[model samples]
Target: MDNLTHSLVGALLGQAGLKRKTGLAMPTLIIAANIPDIDAIAVLLGGDEHLALRRGITHGPIAMVLLPLLLWGIMLWYDRWQTKRGARPEKRLPVDAKWLLMLAYIGCLSHPLFDWFNSYGIRLLEPFSSQWFYGDTIFIIDIWLWCALIAGVWLSLRGERRGQPSWRVPAITSMAAIILYIFANGLITGRAEQLTGRAVQSQFGIVPAMVVANPVPVQFWKREMLWRDSNHYGQGVFSAPDQVVLDPKIGQHEMSNTFALAELSKDKNAKAFLFWSRMPVLREELREESKVRILSDQRFGNPLVQDRFRVVVPTEQDAK
Candidate 1:
């Protein structure tokens, strides 16, 4: 999920009445919600390092425990510092250490849950297992979710300002709606994968080793399904009861040369990319009499975005 969505979730939690628990509760929630993303600094290392480290240890169990504690300490110190300087607001509620810690944990936990809803995947058990987990239920940046959350927070805040009896109703309703939407999308993804898998087996006579239903923008009912068998990769369009239309550009380009792939893995970028790529496809290009091995993940391997997620290796001979 994007940072704005994460921030909105924290705001929604606050508006849903968690704000009354302690001083600076809203800020604590918002900050804690984005704490796990501290691993985003991995981008500075360049190449595919971000993919290797982005959602790893910072989103795992160990960081889950330590991060909230760290945020709790910082919030406690902030409150004390403000009071010591005599700059604390008089109407501010007393800071409750227990409540602050609880809010921190709640906000931090929400980060990984929302992240898992997208097809990009996350390492829930990072340092301990290094396994990737995917939900494939929603797009990375969902406009619908943003609109609902924003409306809820705005309405709730307005009602509160007007001293309405049920000021939190809007936020609560929005949260409920978001939950239902995610559940419905999950059902859609599962059904799409099932239908596409069956169609792939029946039409192509190949049992896919993995099938993913990737959510697209705007049209939530539709999915761009990508499937891969041991030898080939293919895609299809899936909608509702019986719409599974396979694309005609399916190819047996997974990896014909295991030796070449192994040799290329010696490079740092290729290794990191392979470590992160769920469905990698390799193809060769001829340029200036040199064989350029282009490796990319099937999800974002299209021509337009290939450069963004690709690693090129120079090979003396063409890979067979």
Candidate 2:
């Protein structure tokens, strides 16, 4: 999901079965987990943010199947050279080179598997297919899950006994908490939508065109409710999210066509940059030149963000 999150997971995996000086495994898993994102290179060097490139070759099953073996081979060669020179490799991996290959495979594949829980999904099947697969679980980085892992690592390290600690307990506990949190958030979001809907009906005396609810920090929420009335707009933050009015400045008819509306409504791109993009506050501008540009609202601090992904309109009005 993010670097820190990946590091935490790597640490957890690193500690699982390695012997002396195994801390290297933590970084190994961390870097391995992120190897799939090397497609970012395709972004920087190519300057063409094509979906096939970003979500295709790298995230596909082929990468997970092939890259780890390559990494292990490179590592093996480096280790053989160091040993011949009578030098020890720093953070030496303890397992036999061949066995380590297997571990590398597991570590590398786990990342894409876990990432599928998010709505963004992944192109795991790759060259076989480009379809995105999603599991609709986990917030990607739930604090509760982080806490469980951290707490376990801390308690085990402090050692009520020897250098060994009971990491198993914490890992199991954390996994359970992660699952529970995902399910809970799913339910909570639905309830929030209903509450928001009733609140809108009670206040505006009309049902909104749409209601989208999502969790925020501190057990609170932020929502976006679209009103059907022309030139009318609805916006709010809970618990007063129900009250909305016709904001003539951004009316219903001003909303773009079906494709534009779908892009905004399911602004998964915005959701991808949760910290920097506020989907609800984002504004879509249809240039008179017939191009679509989704702009961020400065009020939410989205203006300072640098990453912006371009998506095709599915159809073009004219040939380029």
Candidate 3:
């Protein structure tokens, strides 16, 4: 999920009654919600280093515990500072250490839960185990979710301003609706994967080793399916009973030589990409007498969008 969604979720959680528990509760939730993303600093290192680190340690089990504690302490210090300066708002509830810590934990945990819904995947057990997990239920940027969250927050604010009773109801309802929406998408993804897997086997006469059904933005019932077999890879758009195979190609041809590609995987960038990629494919090109191999993850690799994480390696002869 994008940072906006994360922030909105945090704000909604605060509106859903958590704000009454302590001073600066809303800021604690909003900030903690986006805290794990501090790992994004890896992007400054350039290359695919960010890809290798994005959802790793900062989102792992160890950091999950420590990060919230840090946020809790910071929020408490800020509250004390405001009090010392005589700038604390009269309407602001007194800060409670226990409630602040609890909100911090809730906000921090929400980050990974939302991230798990997208195809980008997350390393929940990183450091301990760098395994990636995917929910395949929502697109990275979901307009519907944005609307739901925004509307809920807007309505809640309006109610509060109007001095209406039960101002928190809208936020609570929105959170429940979002959960149901996610559940529905999960069911759709599972069914679409099953249909795509069966259709691929029927059309290609080969069982797919893995199949992923990624949600299409704005099209709730539609999914983009990618499947792989030992020798070939296939992609298609699936809508319930119908499956359209857009591209089916021999997977072996993706690489010029299996041995060369395997050897190239030893590179640090290549190793990181392989570890992170869920549906990897390769393309080889010849420049002069050298072999240029480009490895990509098929999940996000399309003709129009060449934004897939790629690791280019030239053979030793070409390096010369």
Candidate 4:
């Protein structure tokens, strides 16, 4: 999920009454919600290094424990610093160390949960386990979620400004609605994957090794299905009301030679990209005497968006 969504979720949680638990609760929640993304700095390393480090250690169980504690200590120190300078807000509620720590945990835990809702995937256990997990239920950036969170926070804030007794109602209701929406989308993804799997088996006489039902923007009922078998992989559309249409342009792997793959895998960039790619495909091109092999993850590797999510390895001889 995007940082805005994470921030909005934090605001919604605060508006839903978590803000009352401690001084600076809202900021703590908002910052904690986006803390794990500190790993985003890995992009500075260039190439596929970002993929190798992203959503890994910083989002793992170890960070989950340490990050909140760090945030709690910082917030406590900040509060005391403000008091010493006589700049603390007079209207602010007294800070409760316990509640502040609890809110930090709540906010930080929400980060990985929301991140796992997309097909991009996340490594929950990280150092303990490098395995990637995907929800494939929501798009990375979802307008619908944004609208709900924004509306909820707005309404709740309005109620509070007007001194209404039920100021938190809107935020709580919005949270419930978002939860239901996520659950429904999960069901949709499950059904789409199951139907696509059966259809692929029937049409191609091969059971797919993996089937991903990726949700698209705006049209939440529709999914872009990417299915892979031992020998081939293809894309298709799965629309609601029982419609499944598979594209005819099936893709095959051209890098079948063991020695060639070993050589290409020797490239750190290639290794990292392959480690992160869920649906990998390869294309070989000749440049003078050397062969340039470009490996791509089918999910984001269409011609329109080719440069990203890809790795290029140059070889002197052609792949056998």
Q: Write the per-residue lDDT of candidate 2 for residues 196-250, one digit (tens) a residue.
A: 6676677777676655453333342333333333334454444333433322333
Instruction: Give each model a TM-score.
Output: 0.96, 0.60, 0.94, 0.96
lDDT of 3 by residue, 1-320 (tens): 89999999999998888988988899999998999999999989777757888899999999899999999998888888988999888898989899999999999999999999999999999889989999999998999999889988888988988998889999989999999999988888998888888878887787988889978778877888888876578788877545456556545525345786677676777777777788877777886767887878878765665565778877656766
The ten-residue window of minimal lDDT in model 4 covers 252-261
* Model 4 lDDT per residue over 206-287, tens place: 7999999988888899999999976688889999867899987877855455675787777888889878888888777778
Give all candidates' CA lDDT scores: 0.91, 0.52, 0.85, 0.91
User: Model 3 segments beyond 4 Å from truth?
Assistant: 241-258, 288-290
CA shift at 87, candidate 1, in angstroms? 1.5
Between candidates 3 and 4, the one scoring higher on lDDT is: 4
